[model samples]
Target chain A: MKKSFHLFYIFIVSISIVVLPSCTKQKGCTDNTATNYDSEAEEDDGSCTYNAETDVEIHFSSMVGTESLVYNQEYTINGRKVKFTRAQFYVSEIHLHQADGDLVHLEDKYLLVHGEEHAYSIGKVASEHYHGISFSVGLDSAANHSDPSTYAADHALSSLDPNYTHWNWNSGYVFIRLEGYVDTTAAANGDADFGFFYHVGFDEFKRDIDLDISQDLVGSTAEIGLEIDFAKFFLGVDMRTENSTHSMDNMMLAEKIADNADDAISAE
Target chain B: MLTMQFQLSKNINRLTNAGVIPAFVSFFLLLSSCGKDELISDTAYNLEIPKGFPAMDIPLDNQLTVQRVALGKKLFFDNILSRDSSVSCASCHLPEYGFSDPEQFSKGVEGRSGFRQSMTLTNVAYNTLFFWDGGATSLELQLLAPIENPGEMDMNMPELIERLSNNHEYPSLFREAYDREIDPFTITRALAAYERTLISGNSRYDKYMYHEKNDALTESEKRGLEVFNSSRTNCSQCHSGFNFTSFGFENNGLYEYFADSGRARVTTLHSDVGLFKIPTLRNIGVTAPYMHDGSLTTLEQVIEHYQAGGKLHENKSPLITGFQLTTQEKTDLLNFLNSLTDYEFISQTAE
Candidate 1:
């Protein structure tokens, strides 16, 4: 009977060694900071989920005076009626001023904003409050002269669709493309038959726009609203006489438009 | 040891039951087949550097390789680069005509004429800047312009990539040459690699000047060389050096009102208004219709234009002060220019 009892004890011990671990040690995400953290877990499963970093979405809207600007829509500017067929520009080298006085520079980032598209995510950043924002209207010299084909398909600098922003002959990106028809008639009553293109580009014509505004990005996402006023964009210029400028073709007009960009764009 | 054997047999039985064993064997066979298919032979290509010419400055990333040159030569002659596949680089730059088109302005897809004449690719590896306006900084970058220009190939980079990637033969060829898939980087580098091999320093002039061959040039041709180097003619002032071009942008007074605006289109400076990049005079006999506009049809017209001091323009080169040449001197100058043609360079078949 003692020998039988010893055998039973050995079997019990072997069973316990095999089965105790399965019952006692729970395998799950061991990180307490993770969203799916299991408090009862004693072993890590290498599966953990964490909160995403704060992302900033910059929204751009085109405006002609009071109403929102629409493509193929006519608007009166400088006492002349104009209708925009295409409106696009590149915004590059965005910088956000944090509340702690540290500037967050978004390196090698570019956004090819069009009249149709509204919002673009500038990617994730540290969660904090920002005081001001600064960005360039065009690409820097290095980015401007880089081979567009090297970029990914979805990249702003890629030579994909909506590629009219690049000047193939000149080997540079057109900073701002504002093409439309304007009424150049003497009485200003005729149809807007005159087509004008303001393709501002080249390194010298790149303009920097800085604005002081309050933005809190302490959450998962934050938004910044900006508007480009066409009425103010055509400020200090007579569209009837100055109907066209391909940057190098008419430097004076391109410079006027580039200089006027600071006042033309503002925080909404 | 018995337990280990049992465990091993059990694992093998499980694998066999799950059909993993056959799958593993087939996967290895597939991998071996792929290896055989992409057997890339990377043989180094020795570019024959012509005598009297400096060693070619090849990009570090794109060294000369036999497979790369062969692939580039095929691409050069292929018409698949265009939008409609109607024209190729060779269409505008024919190898027989010193890699230049006979037309005043080379036509593109659908017969669309370009603004400037197609420049010769003879010794194009020596060029510092590309295009009439010096728009492109490198030969690799220069190919992008012609490919994307609406008046040229009329094709974008993304589309070209798609087309090349879809081709059955190009992918393997590209893999063998560049060890990468077909992309802009490989395409541009390969084309440039072949063009850099177009060495043109085997002319009669080279024999006479560098090889010390006394009977290489005639007495009349010798006199023409004197006139060319003479300070009175100033021919060699802008068109200097072994390649016959200083590679500088100068307003040659081609126009008074400045229709095209030449180099100013790039620099945006008023002083650079009518300036265009000086072209190489090598193989001038075959690459005809001279000047950026291709307005002058013959060498005599070009010489006459220089003799007449070019058209009047404020930004004209100060060196454009005209010179006088006798009829015999004109023939000798013409003969000397013809001697620059390298029959071996142009007529040689692809290796």
Candidate 2:
């Protein structure tokens, strides 16, 4: 009877040792630097916040070197004059890399850049002292090759409303679209308006750009100026031989345009 | 065994704390005493998710119940839903033919032919669009189309309601399925619920790929899988994923010009003139007379069309760049396509 009682006591102790700690563990923000960090927390509750979120706006300044881009107006590039009709690109995965080695990712940071809707309202980010703001040129690979129609109507990748940036046949997005009439007739700058429609795509052609931009958010919203040189888009490229790429089959040409897209943006 | 005993003891302690064991026993006893005419319990139906299928997004308001699915199945097979009570949903969408018509275009109640071919309903729960033209966004909405169509059942809404209300079984069925009287919302909801249950994932390819059944596929079928997935062929560009369709519209170069504007009529986009929704390749062996217009009669002819590279067809997608296939490769690809036929799904007897 004595031996049996001791065995029962040992079994109860073992069970308590196994399960009691888990039951008693308090959950809260465990990060020490976070505003809501609890010193007594043993489990992370995902309520960690470094500071209050401040709204940030990113505005694009579309230009051709010294000349500002005007729709349907002529611009000289590589001694070839061209009239720009429509120019658009996607910017995504925007982040703020802090000096403290911590990173803050902007939620839903997909920006559709066009002449009309050039500015991107990069939603709220924690108001913390940061070294620089970094963002990518195109959508992340996760969002690539996915059915955009699956998303809600007002979603960034939705195929409804303001028209989709994706292709119907290839089941991929056109990362950048440049359409206009280029001077393809002459040796230098020509008079004839031979049309050019360049639609660049492919996940392999997706580029990332890290801009060393510093901003101090004293107010609720911060406006950051972004500039894209449309002239540099067709550098070291002849428009005469290869004008249109609606198919997105030319990998070599797509790579060139993708490389140029990295240098396309500047912190204005 | 020791842990199981300990768990049982812990559960007993919990039950003792709640003190509801007697109530639970009495509840079951009361349930057992009820007859068939009594109110059926509304326990959420256990929808079986096949190996390759994702969790379905069932609407919160219209939760699936055993009675609802049973009612839907009964309604689907019944001719009373038709105007003249001569045809049912099963007339066009035959189960033996993978829920598709054997004919090029399924005939209506008046024996008049339709424009497009009947699309296979295999794994249709995962579809983004409900129709070839994507006229209806949801399955619930699409159910009304066939019922109201002049060439289809031709039963108007008012007449349908009147007929359903008059039917002795329908009122009780609706009450059991939806806890309400006969209504349009309940009718559509029940139909959609039953249709979503028509899942098929037990194909030889699914067994081989998901269940790791190596012997499920033949050597020719294995080699054919390689050809189908090959970059040279580019078949997987559109006809990809577990469902064998990305559920997107594309102009696959069926003809130089289309007699019937498939998606273009719905969207009113000039560029979308010849485009139609890509049907699932599941049960492809049985579901033919193929394509939107059902122009191609056999799988061999469809393969030949892709092999020829849609050269004559102007609106063909640029991805349809022709590929050279040897006689062996062609046979292998066909074998792979045949491997998608789910025998278990076609022969299913249970609701």
- Judging by lDDT against the true structure, name the best candidate: 1
Instruction: Output the lDDT of residue A8, model 1.
Output: 48
RMSD per prediction, one decimal? 10.1, 14.3
Clashes of 2: 0
Error at A43, model 2, angstroms: 41
Off by over 4 Å in 2: A1-268, B1-40, B311-314, B349-351
Q: What 10-residue stretch in candidate 2 chain B is worst by lDDT?
A: B22-31
Cα lDDT tens digits, model 2, B1-351, are 344335534643443345445434533343355333344567678999988778988876567888888888888877777888877787888888899898999987879678889888788778767678776656765776676566778765446767888987888888878776665677778888888889999899999999999999999999999999999898988998888888898888777878876777555466887889988999999999998888899999999989988755556688887889999999999999999999988775424
Among all windows of 10 consecutive residues in model 1 chain B, the one with the lowest summed lDDT is B1-10
Shift of residue B241 alpha carbon in model 2, Å = 0.6
Tell me the interface RMSD of every candidate, in Å: 14.8, 13.6
In order, the first chain's TM-score in every candidate is: 0.80, 0.78
